[model samples]
Target: MGATRSHRIPRRAAHPALAAAIAAAALALTTACDPVGGLNSAAVAVTTDQVATAALQHQHVDIKWLTCTAHLDNGPRATPSAGSATKDVADVTCDGETKDGRPITVRGTVTQEVEGRCVKGDLTAKVADRTVFRASVLGDCTAPAPTTTRVTPAPGGHPTVTVTVTVTQSFQGK
Candidate 1:
């Protein structure tokens, strides 16, 4: 009998170099499709005022204070030489009104994680240690009454108040 002959095609593995090239090409294509600057984009730095505004908004409760007053233990410190500087810790009290002009008073503590204008995790806000403080848009945090003795003391090496205006809208500044 004649010798039987069998023919079969051998399978070959993909080249490592070819696989790597394909992967690199795919990555490049994905990155090129990005319109806005991705990782390479530079973020604009915000001011301390901006961050403070955000922290205030974090309270979630609105206090119409545009005409009221505020005292911060470590809020915004005014310097006789230059401008004011934001503090790291603060005990703040804002006496103002609500949107409807009801009187309201809000107190809280704000802390700046870092000494910068950034306020992501660096900014923290906590309401005053109280159950519920009366707030309104038609009146001040407290009803107007006669004063016994006037007292105004500095926060003791803390920022006092830079803005007396109550903030309703979010901080929309750069």
Candidate 2:
């Protein structure tokens, strides 16, 4: 009988540029999809703007600039509760000056909603050591119900099926 020989195929290495590009794309996707951090920043900005607006309305003399800051009370690791995903909270402070050079200040705490997008909280604005405005703001984070889709092959043609599910989240506020 004749001797039998085996031959093996060689594997090729990935190109360095291609590999780098893939890594960069992955990193970008990871950062962009960070729900918690993104939500926190957005919530803070919105809350600050709302507070400033309320203060302006109460003062009715804002002719200068206003700045606000928020300090997270629960930090990043805080988890939402089982019944309600209300966990993230921040203490906010704002300062500005009116056209007449009067000092304006706002203070409050903001709470993140279950959906992780909207917020609800109460804020108080003071002008020159006098309380001028106080109110509570609510953000609507209602999401639609989940939807499912199924695809089945024709009878006796092939025993194959495909299923898909979709979920969505949204935020609304004044």
Best by lDDT: 2
Report every candidate's CA lDDT.
0.28, 0.44
What lDDT score is found at residue 75 in candidate 1?
Answer: 33
Supply the TM-score for candidate 1. 0.24
Query: Over the stretch 59-133, how does candidate 2's per-residue lDDT look in tens digits?
Result: 564535455555556554534554444455667676766656788777787664223223457777777888886
- Weakest 10 consecutive residues of candidate 2 by summed lDDT: 1-10
C-alpha TM-score for every candidate: 0.24, 0.46
Q: Using TM-score, give the best candidate's number.
A: 2
